[model samples]
Structure formats: structure tokens, C-alpha cells
Target: MANPWHALEGVQVSDLGEKYFLFKFFKEVDIHRVIIGSPWTFKNHLLILHRIHENEDPLSIPLVLADWWVQIHYLPPGFIKESMALLFGNFIGKFLDYAMKNLSNGYKNFMHIQVQIDVRKPLKKKKKIMLSESNLRKI
Candidate 1:
């Protein structure tokens, strides 16, 4: 049977040499149907077969389970900077949550902790630093 999804332009799908797949798209497109439908069908088939062989050795059960994950990368015309900032904020939040849980004792007496983030535009020209005579001699 011919796969209809093969006709999609700017879309590339490749196996990751494991139980994972990498789907890349060059432009914005709706891929919700493919993502939601394919994994369920494959996993459901595994589940059905597992049930049929209920008497199989328990140690071999994990080998028959089907697991899949999808990671989407979408870069629009002007949203790259905004998306990167959002991702950075998410990472910081997760890191703080983990640190607070593990190092709770260090912050127990503090009323509040303030975090300041400075974001500035990069300079077009690089500035050279002048070295003192003594510093040059040490080098």
C-alpha cells in the first residue's frame, strides 16, 4: 500500500537506529494526526500480542513492550528569539525546583530569594584589552 504521508513536502522522517524516530519539517504544518495515530496503533498491537501469550516467561515481558516518543521542532519566521527565551526560562525554573528540593536546608532561614537576569544586545565591534607591562612580563 502507498503511504499517503510520503507525499508531504518539506517533511523528512528517519529512524534513529533504535526504537525512536526523527521527524523533521522545514515549514509550519499540522502533524498532530500522524503523531497521535501511529504510536497508538503500534503499541496497541504489542499489547494485543502480549495478552495472547499470557503464559510467556515474566522475565521476557519487557522485551515485548512497545514504547515511542515524539519530539517536534518548529521554527517560524520571527519567533526564534522568543522561543529560545521561553525555553531558557523553563530550564531555569526546573533547575531551581530541583535545587530547592535537594538543598532545602540552606534556604530554610531565608525570607525570600530574588533573581535578576540581565539581557542585552551584543556589540557589533569587539574591544581589545590592553595588558600592563608587568602582566606581559609574567606571560
Candidate 2:
């Protein structure tokens, strides 16, 4: 039988420590498909995909301001920042691994990784009015 993980053979993996690994691909990969297909394989990893810039330090890779970004929620009382960082690192690693293996055909449109946070404000409460009174006035 062929190895199921064979596709990922070319991906470069780095240990970021704290259970975080960095997976880097040599070519651009479709982030949308990666995200859509991630849950099946990366159930335990938080997968974050970002474009790798040439000559730029990975630590300073500016966040892409696009529609696809990770949302950070208030952690339950005991969750620490270190834990969150590890989770994010794991995601980045897994995403790179998946992209390298699955997106090898060619680069697709909108292939860059973009990040944006969606903020939804609660709707204001509306005051109740008497419909009958309004109807009577109209009559």
C-alpha cells in the first residue's frame, strides 16, 4: 500500500518547541482549500497559514489584512498566554504541512494567506409599540 503521508514528504518541518512545529512549503498554496480540508486531518492542531516572505524575518511577518484570520476568544479563567501561543504555533505548522502536500498542482487565485477579525456588535433593543393604536390612527 502507498503511504498516505507521502504527499507531505517535501514539506519542511521545524520544531518551535512547546509542542509547536513550523511547516514551510517551497511554493505558494491555496489557503481556502487548506482551511476547508483541515478539520479532517488536523483535528488536534490549530492550523494557521501565512505567506512566507523572502528576506523578511519570520518573526516580523506582518499580519495579512484579509477576510481569513483567526479569532481569539477570551480563554476560560485558567488558560494562559503560553498555551494560546503554542496552539497558534501548532496551527501554523499543520497548515504548512497540509498546503505543501495538497496544493502542489499550481498556485490558484487568491492564494495568499490573509487575516481579518470579524467583530459583530449586538443589536440594540427596539422599543415595543402598540400596533392597534397605529392602525386606529390610520383608519
Candidate 3:
């Protein structure tokens, strides 16, 4: 089905009808799923897949950072910037979790997940780059 997330403002869905599909439920197009079949190629940059299920047969929608950036860059002037950061961070975290749990396996190359946080007070120095390794070390 056509990517539900792609339907979001400013995000583009490639290969529609040719590879992707748009399914209707209850005559509403908003509640459909985006299914990426196997043998997919994640060109340059990270190939992010948001896992929707845990069963052997699951649906993974392909996402890219560039596309996300485009969406964020084109956001309406009235929208708060923090909202974009939060969405991007959440997407990054979810994508990283999925990759570490699923795609990182059976691979020789090592992968890393990085998260940025601004924990200091408003008058603080700057934001912090909290690597995922630090959390794992603590555990």
C-alpha cells in the first residue's frame, strides 16, 4: 500500500503504483499501510524501516534522512521548530532500534546509534551529544 507516512505533508512517495500501492479501508484512505517487499535496495544514506509488526511476515516502510530533512525544511513558518526536532529524534531512535535488532545481525560491519539532547537549563551552554554506547555501558 502507499506509505501512510508519505502522505504526510511535504514527504514524497516514490514508485507509487509501480511498486507501492494505495489501499482503502472503510472508504478512508488515511488508515492504510505501506508495505515494502523483500529484496529492496537502500541506495546511499541510511535505509530506515519503521517496523509495524513482529510476525515473520511484517511490513517495513522505507524512509530516508534526506526525505525527512526536506519535510522539516518545508514546514510552515507557524510550526514550532522543536516539533521538527522531536519528530526527527523519535524517528531516528525508532529506526536505530529496528536496525540494531534486525538489520545489524549477520553483518560484519559495526553500527552505531547517536542521539542528541539539550538537558541544560535555558541559560545553559549548549546541547549534548549522547551516544548510544554510553547507555549500553551503564547497563
Candidates' C-alpha lDDT: 0.32, 0.36, 0.32
Candidate 1 lDDT at 102 equals 16
What is the Cα-based lDDT of residue 44 in candidate 3?
Answer: 38
Q: Superposing every Cα of model 3 onto the true structure, what RMSD results?
A: 16.4
Which 10-residue window of candidate 1 scores lowest in summed lDDT?
93-102
**Clashing residue pairs for model 3:** 1-21, 2-21
Q: Model 1 segments beyond 4 Å from truth? A: 36-139
Question: What global local distance difference test value does model 2 have?
Answer: 0.36
Q: Candidate 3 on 35-133: residue-level lDDT in tens?
A: 222212334323334333446222344433221211223222232234435544454432212122123455323222223222231212223444466
Expressed as tens digits, the lDDT of each residue in 19-84 for candidate 2 is: 444555443443334434442225554344454556755555433222332333333323223443
By TM-score, rank the candidates, best first.
2, 1, 3
Query: CA RMSD for every model?
Result: 20.9, 17.1, 16.4
**Candidate 3: misplaced stretches above 4 Å?**
1-26, 29-31, 34-136
lDDT of predicted model 3: 0.32
* Runs off by more than 4 Å, candidate 2: 1-9, 18-20, 27-43, 61-115, 118-139
As a TM-score, model 3 comes out at 0.17
